[model samples]
Target chain A: MRVRLRRQATLLATVAGLLLAATPVAQAYEPVNIVHTEKVQAGPYPITVGFSTWPLRAIQSLDFTFAPDGGIEGKSGTLTMTPATRSTESRKRPLVRHPRKLEVWGLDIRALEEQGDWTFRFRLDGPEGPGEGALTLTALEPPGPPMALNWSLSTLPLIGLVAFLAIAWRRTRAEVLAG
Target chain B: MDLTAPGAHGVRAAATPRTAARGMPTAMALLAGSVLGLVGLTWDVQWHTDVGPDTFFTLPHLFIYAGSALSGLAALVAVLGATAAARAGRPLDPTVGGASVGVFGRTFTAPVGYLISGVGAAVFLLYGMWDLWWHGVYGFDAVIDSPPHIGLLLSGIVTMVGTIMVFAAAAEHRWGRVGTDVSIALTAANVTITVLGLTDVGGPVDAVHTAMAWLVVILLLTAAGFRPTRGGAVIMAGWLAVIQAVTWWFSPWAAYAYADAVGLPVRDYINGVPVMPALMPMALIAVALLIEPILKAARAHGNRWLPVAAGAVAGALVAALQGIQDSIVYTYPTPGPGTLLPTAVAGALLGALAGHLGWRFGHMLRLVNRTRPEGN
Candidate 1:
């Protein structure tokens, strides 16, 4: 019975050691590198941020993801985003498992107001240690629909005005000449 | 000017005594309704920016509806009154007689302006329905220049133009300078609304286009449509300034407070500060000042080209002055000289066209009022 117990313990220790060895290999696969408008290196981690709506206009949604050099398999953290121009309170959200990506932490922000540089601060506490980092992104003028589309829509009123005036003028001319 | 003279279109004029007593109320109603409509539109824009769209029956919408309803009702009453008097074999009130137009095989008495205004109100109502449906289908518009919005603005412009016509005609009927003053005020208000509605052209980058358009249209209309009166353009510029300043000062705060009250998480900042205030119509004063001398020279020398020349000068001045102001004050990127030069040329051409059109339209209105026929 003692020899059988020793064999089982040895088997469990070998499996645990193998599993531990595979973690770095899995983490080496690198969180999906998203093309981002702004990137920052927070203590031991690289954070990439971008507006989900392209061209980074005002009043748009934001996407932020953090990939620590050591990976996020056993890490916990928080992200705080604040607009530099606004006095509004900074928004704090827990770093959680990204819905779409594995081994990554992310936050999806619904709307950003005003156009300017927004600061993003990240705080992470993990097996390696605790670290902080900040990044700034410049928000642009709210990108509108295509210029052609906007100009065409705006010109409708001018066309209508001109048409109405032409018709009125014709009718009045007819009436005056007849009188 | 004899108030009872037979006007154009075989329409008999109303007796002077009755017109003197009854005209004041109708004129006052038209002015009030049009002005209220302008105010409502301004408020609606504020609501759109601050709170986003809520319901079809918001407070600002009610204001617009009330204004339209009042103007339409007043015009309807005048038409019905004139038709009744005509049937009863009484002299048509000059106030309502010149407005006679045939519709559906019956003679309806309404000033051309009021008729136009009433039609505009009806169309505006229809467009409002379409706007609601559009919002439901495609979602709320992020910008103001939606097709339905453009339709509504065009109708509103027609309504205001009609109001101006009504007052201008009244002024011709010896209603005094007060009538002229009211017309000028309405013109200013119309210009303000037009500028506001065209937000695309009013942006910091596109302000030059707006300035050119404003200078040409306004200078031409004021110079040609109204009788030459010293300071008329100045008064209009003053009115524009006052309306812009007042609305700018109060609208954002009111919008923000309402949003907060409703628990909407709308951001009030643009860049690092509060959203930019409404653009001022200050360049118009320069155009107005230029118009005065041109109008005087045209009247004194009977120069046919003077109106066009005046418009060109006003347009050039507007482009240069406004371009400089926009760059310095708004921090908008300075447009190249190439951009400015073309703007001036386009402004001059447009001004000339507007001058010709305004002159023709103004003459048509005067002729229609002076040739009323007996019995019909």
Candidate 2:
């Protein structure tokens, strides 16, 4: 009886170990696949750009590449986003039909002035459209502040007065209680 | 005869009976201090930037010149006097006679009142440049609405400062004197400005809106002057409703008129994308009006449902406006998420119901004596 119980326990342990090992492999599997790729070079840096032909049936896969002087020191960038609701039109339309641009906001990049080829390589599981394509865009200097400092400085006195009041109030309150 | 008495300085002279001696001085002092302070603010030849059709210029901008500089000067004087008194060994006689100046200059301090009033007025007036430059109201592209687009970097800073001052005065009750008076004055000014806009005098609506912005400030001051009451709540709600109606109906009319003046046959297109925009402002105003009633009802009745009902009313108003606007705008029944009618209707109904019930069960459950103290 003891030998039979030990054999059953060993079998259970082995099966659990196998399931744990397969978990990552299963999770990594995605429906959207990237096929074509392009690397735009600016000096030493490289920007790898990629896109899918159709809206991904489901985003099943994604990968990124970091080029030297791309301001991102190493291959250490991640992309995460939700897709817009897929309408019937989206299914009927090809990925390249319109400007299917994946707009990324708040990229914490420094030394944008540094000349280097920055490439962003990405993969997506798309609908039955262009499996994948790549495009390159140049980084340009952003525009100026909407209102001039001269315009804003007009309110500085108001700002300063409020600050003064707050400080004075605190001091007076303390003195009044102490006295 | 003794000015040293608690109420002597602030009350009517004994022999004079009707005329208040002390109150008069206090009032005069506040007025004089503010005017003098106004001079002091402009004492320095400061180059005030005005955003115009062209780039930034040192030329006098109406709002910056009038509102910020003048009001800011008044605030400076008031603050200086108050601070000086605070620094002096006089113990800062806040409760002069019968007037109650609460902790940390809560109610009107003579100097503080002047300063805040001036600055508040100035800030309120400065909206002309903002409207012209940001919203592209004068046939400019909508893209100029962006912060970086207009070269007015300090827009955010000025807005933040103004907002803080407005809120601070409201919180500190300095609003009772400076903020309130300024708001009333501004509202009156706005009424005139709107008339000018209606006449199409060929200028930005800054003058009109600058005046209009004072309406909320005045209403708030009036509300604060009175105790919390069903009537006051209703008044607040009514004010909000009026604002909503005006924003919805009048704003559209105004926009259409402007479009017509510019030679665009947009009166019929008013039912288009314009209608959708119209509903947003209306719904916003409706929500503002109903929020207080729901809370008050919830507190008075202890009925958790009162707020819910109020919210439903607000939501219904919003949804109806949105539907009306959408029907005007869209010719085809695009039954999807992006469609204006369905989205606005759903939002209004759900929002009103949820907000009413949520608030009823939440805050605004306390009933204070809702009555206005006759005169300040």
Best by DockQ: 1
lDDT of 2 at B361: 15
lDDT tens readout by residue for model 2, A22-141: 333211112223354455443333445443221211211122222222233222232222122212211111111011112221111111121222223222232222122223323332
Provide C-alpha RMSD values for all models, in order: 20.8, 25.3
The numbered model that scores best in lDDT is 1
- What DockQ, between 0 and 1, does each candidate earn? 0.05, 0.01
RMSD of 1: 20.8
DockQ of 2: 0.01
Provide the clashing-pair count of each candidate structure. 12, 46
Tens digits of lDDT, candidate 2, B1-376: 1112122123121212122232223333333333322221121111110100121221122223333443354444544544454444233322111211222433233322333344444544454465454333222212222322212212222322232222223321332233223322222222221222222222322222222222222232233222234443334434444433443443344434433333323211122232212222233344445556555655566564554455555444444444444444555453344443443444445644444433421121111101112222
* lDDT of each residue in B20-63, candidate 1, tens digit only: 55765566566666766766666666766544534555556666
**Minimal lDDT window, size 10, model 2 chain B:** B44-53
Specify the highest-TM-score model's number.
Answer: 1
Candidate 2 at A42: error in angstroms? 34
